[model samples]
Target: MAVSFHSRSNSYPSRQHPQAAHVDEQLTRLRSFEAASSSSICQRFSNLQDLHDSLEKMISLSVTNQVLSQDQIEKLLDGSIKILDLCNIAKDSLSQTKESLKEIQSIVRRKRGDLSAEVKKYLASRKFLKKSFQKVLKSLKTGQNKNNNALAVFGEAETVTIALFETIFSFISGSKACGKWSVVSKMISQSTVTCEAEANEFTIVDLEFQSDKSLKVENVQILEACIQDLEDGIESLSKSLIKYRVSILNI
Candidate 1:
C-alpha cells in the first residue's frame, strides 16, 4: 500500500517509473504463481492482494500526470468494477458456505437436531456455489485467449488479474479450470484447496456428508477452521478491491 499522489510519470530517469516498475514486477510474480509446484488457495489470494496493492501505488503516483487518457481511464475503471464484482461474489460464496457449515456443525454438537436435513442443506449450498462459478468461469474464459498486445493500457497486467480471480473462484467452488485459461492449468494442490482431485478440509467434509449423511465432530471443527482462513483471505481481498475502486473514483 505504498500510495502517494501527484508524482509525474516521467520524473524517473529510467525506462519506467519506480512505482510502475514495481507493478510490472508484481505482475510477473503473479503470472508465474500458478506454475509453482506448491501453490495453494491462500497463496493465490495473497499474491492477488500484492498485485492490487502495487497497482494502487502506481495509479496514485500518476493521478496528476495524465498518463492515461480519458478513454483509457474509463476502460480501466470498468475493468476495476468487474474485478470488484468477482471479488464480492467470492466473498458472498464464502460467507454463505460458512454459515451453512456452522449450522450443520451446531446440529452435530447438539446431537438432537434433524441431521439429515442439515446435511442436505449444506450440500445443496455447495452445489449452488459450484453452479454459480460455472457461469462465472465460463464468462471469464470468453476472450481469455485474445491478444493482449491489442490493448496498450495494462494489457498483460489486466489479463493476469482476471486469471488470479478465476483461480481463486474455482478453488472456492471446489472445481477445476475448464482448460481454456492455461495460466491456471498447473493449479494442483495437495492441501488448502477445494479442487475435487485435491484432499482439503472442504472436500473431506463434503465427502463425509454426501456418502455417510453425517459429520464427525472433529472433522466439522477442522472444516470450520479452514473456512475461517478462507473467509479472512476473501475479506482482505475485498477491502483491497474496494479501496482501489474508491481511489479511481476520486481520480
Candidate 2:
C-alpha cells in the first residue's frame, strides 16, 4: 500500500544494478520455498527472513536509493513496525495456546474429574483465536499487485511481508491454504472424526478427546512439540524484522 505498483513484474530494464539483481535472486528463492511440497509455514517464513536481510543489505548500501524516495522510506518504516506488531500478536497468541495445552495436559495426567470441561475451555480459547485471525486477515487483504523489478523491490518486499504473515497467522488460525486441507486437518483425517469445528490444533485435540473420554499423552506431546517448533520459527522471524527495522532507521 505504501509503494507504487507496476503493470508488469519484470518491467525494469535489462541492465540493472547488481545489488538489485541480488534482490531479484532472493525473491526467486523465496518463491521457490513454497513451490517445494516439503516446505512448512516455518520453512516458508525462514526463506522470507533471508529475503529481508538481502533487501536490508541492499538498502543499506544505498543501492535502492535511486528508486526509493523519502516518503517511500517513511512508509517502509511504518509498514515494518505494523508487521512487527502483528508478529508480536501472533507470538502472544501462540504462547497462550501453549500454556492452555499445558494446563490440559496437567489435568489429564492427574486423571482428574471433568477433563471434558478443560478441553472445552481450551477449544473456546482456540475459537477466539480464529475470530481474531479472521478480523486481522480481512484488514490485510490488499489485492494481488506484486512486482519483481529491481526498481520495485520496496513494494514487492512489503507484499511478501504481508503475505507471509497472513500465511503464518492462517496456519495458527487453522484456515486452509489455497483451498487445501490445513496441517491439523490432515493429522486428524485418518479416523472418521466428525465435529463442527475448524481444522486446528485445539479442534484436533478436541476430536481426540471426544473419541475417548480422556486425552492421549502422545497426542498432547506431539502438539506441544509442534507448537514449540512454530514458536521458534516465529522468534526467528521477529528477530529478522527487528534487524530490518533498525536498518531502515539507519538509512
Candidate 3:
C-alpha cells in the first residue's frame, strides 16, 4: 500500500492571519486619532473666533472716547496687546493643526481603507477658518487706524481748549472791571464743571467696556450719549472763551 503524505495548503483559510489583524487594529487607532485631532482643531478655531469678536468690541470701546485718563488709556493699550498675543497663539496652533492634518491625510491615503471624505471635510473647514481669520485681522487693522485718528483729534482739541482757558484766565487776572471779571469768573467755573462732567461721562463709558459683559447694545447707547455730552461741553467752553475775549477787547 502506497500512502501519499498530506501536504498543508500554501494559504491558511480557516482564520484571519495575525498580520492582517494587527494592521486592522493599527488602522482603527489611527482613525480614532484622526477624529480626535479634527475635533480639537474645530474647537480651537471656535475659541479663536470668539476671542477675535471680543477684541473687536474692545477696540470699538477704546476708540469711542477721545479723552481717556492715563490709567484708562494704559489699560486699553495693554488689553489690545494681550489680544494680539492671543491671536498669534491661535495662528500658531492653526498652522500646527494643518500640518498634523496633512500628515494624517498622507497616512490615510497609503492605508487600505479610504478616508478621503473625512480628510476633505477637515480641509474645507480649515479653509473657511483661514478666510474668517483674515477678515477679523482686517477689521482689527481698521480699528487701529481709527484709534490713531481719534487720538490725533483729541490732542488737537485738548491743546486748543487748554490755550483758550489760559487766555481767558490771563485776561480776567489783568482786568480792573469788577463786574466784567465776576462774569468771566463764573463762566470759567461753569466751563470747568462742564469739562469735568464730560470726563466723568467718558470714564463711565470706559468702565462699561471693562465690564464682563462689554458688548451690549446698551453700552453703545451709553457711549453715544457720552460723546454727545462731551461735544456739548466743548461747545459751551468755546462759547465762554469767545465771550471772555470779546469782553476783554471791549474793556
In the range 1-251, model 2's lDDT, one tens digit per residue, is: 34553333334443266776877787777655552111377687777778777777777774454445455567777778878888888888989988988888787778776667877787778778878988888888854334445436766777776777777677776535322433255444434343324444544554565454345688677777767877787788889878888887776
| TM-score of model 3 vs. true structure | 0.25
Cα error of candidate 3 at position 237, Å: 46
Model number with the top lDDT:
2
lDDT of 3 by residue, 1-251 (tens): 13232333333221143433443343333224311122332333333333333223322332232233343344444433434343343445334444534444465447654444544454455445445544544444333312343233222222222222222222212212221222114334454334334333223322222333223444335444433333343344334334422332221
State TM-scores per candidate: 0.76, 0.77, 0.25
Q: lDDT values of the candidates?
A: 0.63, 0.66, 0.34
Query: Ranking under TM-score, best-scoring first?
Result: 2, 1, 3
Where does candidate 3 stray beyond 4 Å?
1-72, 75-82, 85-89, 92-96, 99-106, 145-251
Q: Flag the better candidate by lDDT, 1 or 2.
A: 2
Question: How far is each candidate from the true structure, as Cα RMSD in Å?
Answer: 7.8, 6.3, 37.3
Model 2 whole-model lDDT (C-alpha atoms): 0.66
Error of 2 at 76 (Å): 0.4
- What lDDT does candidate 3 reach at residue 89? 35
